[model samples]
Target chain A: MKMAILVIAMLVFANQTLFEQLKEKCELSKNEYLIVIFQTPGNCVKCFIEPMDLVELIKKNSLGINYKLMALVSVEREIELKVFQKENDWKHYMLVDDGNARKDLGAKGIAMMIILDSRGKIMAEFLPNQYDKNIEKAKKFVKSR
Target chain B: MKIILITFVTLTLISSNCTMKTQHILEYKPEKLQTQNLNKINIEPKGIIEIEEDENNIIQQITSVAIIGESNTLALINGKDLLFYDNTTGKFIKKIEATFEMTDLVAKSGRKPYIDSNYERRKVEVPYISTTNYTQNGIDGEIAQQFIKNFFMSLKNINNTFYSFGTIYCYYIGSSEKSIDNIPVLFVLNDELNIESYVVMDLNKNSHAIAYDFYINNYIYLSAPGMYKVPAFGGEFDSYPTAAKYDLEGNFIKSVSHMTNNYLLKGGLKNGWVYPRFIEVNNHIMIVYPEELAVFGENKKLFDLQNLPFKNDSGFVYYQDYLRYCRSKEMRPDIDVIARLFPIKIIDAFENENKFYPIILVWDKNKPMGFYYLIQEYTSDGKLLREVALDDEPENQIRQFAFNKYDKELVLFKKSKTSWTAEKWSLR
Candidate 1:
């Protein structure tokens, strides 16, 4: 009985790269950069506003055709995820994430942003405070070879 | 049993500590508008304007829409192409193409794609495409004459001989490797159909795009949601909502100020964070949300946040309790069923006679199976007027509304099965 319980726990908390998980969930395109925003209900206040700013940034810069901005929501059920997505008008730009994604990415901060290369390699990570800087750096990194 | 009991106690204590208890912001839940008031309302079926979607797909997208008040003229813009219609008759007046080309917005950085990929950084172009190559010849441009001629022809019998055309400003964004630029320009035509102001206003200094701009009392108030100050990322903490008043000729006036907390959560039966909607009511500026009601003084100082009572005790259930209930569902089995049916959002608001009618869009897991929208009206002093079932079809909900204060009527526009339709309802 003890061995079976241990096996179940290990399966539940199996280690996996956040990049791989996001790539699978968001259907990330090849040879294009990816910007993922890690969010949870605990940081719902800031979480609600950052997506709007990011959408504006993407639209103003005409970066939609160049890069993919995906939001990975953590620990939210189906109903909560739907509410968050519909409220934010993020139907096209978000994927529901399990609790493990945050743990895998080491993104414990509120509304942390992670930038990945075309092949799903972690390029840079940014906390909520460094939002504008994160956008600037991501744009530069995405555009650079 | 002892271990489970100890764990439950510890969890409850920890959860209590997690709750952030702020002063409870009040929300109003009014009873239905009295039948006397309801019977007083008169709805007149004026006319229906059918907006057709582009079949050929040549038009990039409909960027903006404007309705010329009283004149009954509607202008729909798709890229540089402008389509005009006589609202009363639903007649297509004319289509004018404006040329917009800003090639100076090319990204300079030699940013390439992945290794071995031959991707080059392309120049960012504004006014991406132009169909016509018409030029401005003189004082009254050639294209402007055609517009005025058609407009005058359509409104032949109007008594007011002298008509002042409305100036509709269009914004175009420009970007390069280093910075982003927003260019706002106003296009107006003279009586003879000439361009009065080729480019009335060009503002590129602000980092964030203007959230909203409207004309009221002879002054155009442009509001920026807030500054892009570092560390805040335009959140409620640092989002400074400031308005710049501009004259008709695009001259700058004084800056308007308002003391507001953008993150105020509307506490009621259906609780959520509410953003402020600013309006000019009876020569005074008022900021209102479904839950919050406040009038600004001459100095733009907001009134104290009022605490209003809820209709039922269920409405008094604070957000901290709600959050705790949602989080610790395993410990508390009774609330599990209730918490699962989470409300979606307050989708729309309509104001009439100092009363705000909020339309809440909620989704219930069992009965409805999909989104259910409800419209509830509340008085200025936090009294519930009436609640009505507005819409159930998620796709068909009121998106844009035009209020006719003179007629004491509210006009609602929504997407019908095939096209869009407008329905007008009397307010008085």
Candidate 2:
């Protein structure tokens, strides 16, 4: 009975280790060319263009580059993202860090973009600017990589 | 038994820690407005001006009309013409041809007019005219008349473009494709249809398309949406609402980023919320939300919370009075309850005489629900004042409510689904 209990404990430990490994592997790190996207709850006519344009630009210029897009939104705004994705046919991974993202990223201003490298280093930060011009710069950066 | 006892004690302590303690203070409730025979009050239905007959006409299909002032005059744009209206008489006063269709108009009073006619005329210097013969003066006369005619036309255009001299100043922003870039040029027009000054508010290119001036304490608060960025979770864009303060001369005072701890829980930041309505009460600006209240106190510190005594669903924060009114949503099924199961819709707020209260109206299913009961709770201490219900209508919904300070009465505009005509009830 003691041997059986030991075996059960070993299995649980193995499962936990495997789960942690999976989480680490799947989760985005500070290093991997991370692009932080700040969005309001609804599809604002002009404000909604930044993310949609960025995704399209990235997809068009995806030349052997690894990048992850993260969304910082409110708790009340989750359903809006789903609707936006479904409507736009967007197939990008999303994270749900609402208020914390704003606090951590210092992104009190919406439509602000921050690009981080694989080393979790912020390489480029774009505050409120023309959407097309900023996206063009982001495209050039991705292309250079 | 010991384990169970310990578990219960632990649970109780955890629950107690989670609950926040709030102070409650008592205040007088205003007497309920008499509901005796609301039908007895004589109310004349204000005629609706059919701006256009075509279904495809944009201005005719106005989903909402936000009345900015109490004056009998209203400046309305139908995507084609800038229309002036006499509100009381429901008469179309005058139509001014605008260079571009504008969605909004801001009025500034007591602005001086400045005109520069030289800027209007582009004259080519006439070479020295040495007339040797006196018989060929007919051609010279025609040439001089033509020059004078062209000069006068140019002056007229300039006068129409930048001439203003009056107590009231109305500025209009014309539609332009260049709106995607710099701040749109605003043309100030006087009461006499003359253009005043073209004020260019040097707005950042990243600012949202819509902007408005909130007048408070002899100051104007200009609110604009900042840029949009992709969210961490991917997909849609998030918006940040940013604001700036400007003096009467259009001098930039300061730019403030309005940040809130509450954001979307799922993937992206809340980006699209714009047009924050400011309410000033006793030297305090109450940035009110349907659920939360952000009080810019006298100390200049911003206080925000959702811990008021009233339910979140039934309450609305009146920005002007710094009063939060909580009313029941009787008819709207889509409207969430106090727990925020749905979005809160505040129907109207009206005041009569010394007693000021906002009327809570909502739509449930096909029927309209009216929460005539009003309450005001302050944030400093949970001081509460319960006001009496003015009227009750289980079937008929109150579509609009207006308060006339001159008459010291609360006007309730009711719309019945059964009847074609709407009824108005005045509480004196």
Please state the CAPRI-style docking class of candidate 2.
incorrect
Q: Candidate 2, TM-score vs. the true structure?
A: 0.38
Mark the regions of model 2 whose C-alpha exceeds 4 Å error after superposition.
A1-145, B1-71, B75-82, B96-98, B101-179, B182-198, B205-209, B227-241, B263-271, B290-340, B346-428
Task: Report model 1's chain A TM-score.
Answer: 0.63
- TM-score for each model: 0.43, 0.38
User: Which candidate should be chosen as best, given DockQ against the real structure?
Assistant: 1
The DockQ assigned to candidate 1 is: 0.03
Give the lowest summed-lDDT range of ten residues in model 1 chain A: A75-84
- Write model 2 residue lDDT over B140-199, tens digit each, in one string: 433332121100000001111222111111122122110112132344556554455644
Worst 10 residues of 2 chain B by lDDT: B148-157
DockQ of each: 0.03, 0.01
**The best candidate in terms of lDDT:** 1
Residues B186-242 of candidate 1: C-alpha lDDT, one tens digit per residue: 445433323444323323222121423333346544443323222232232432334
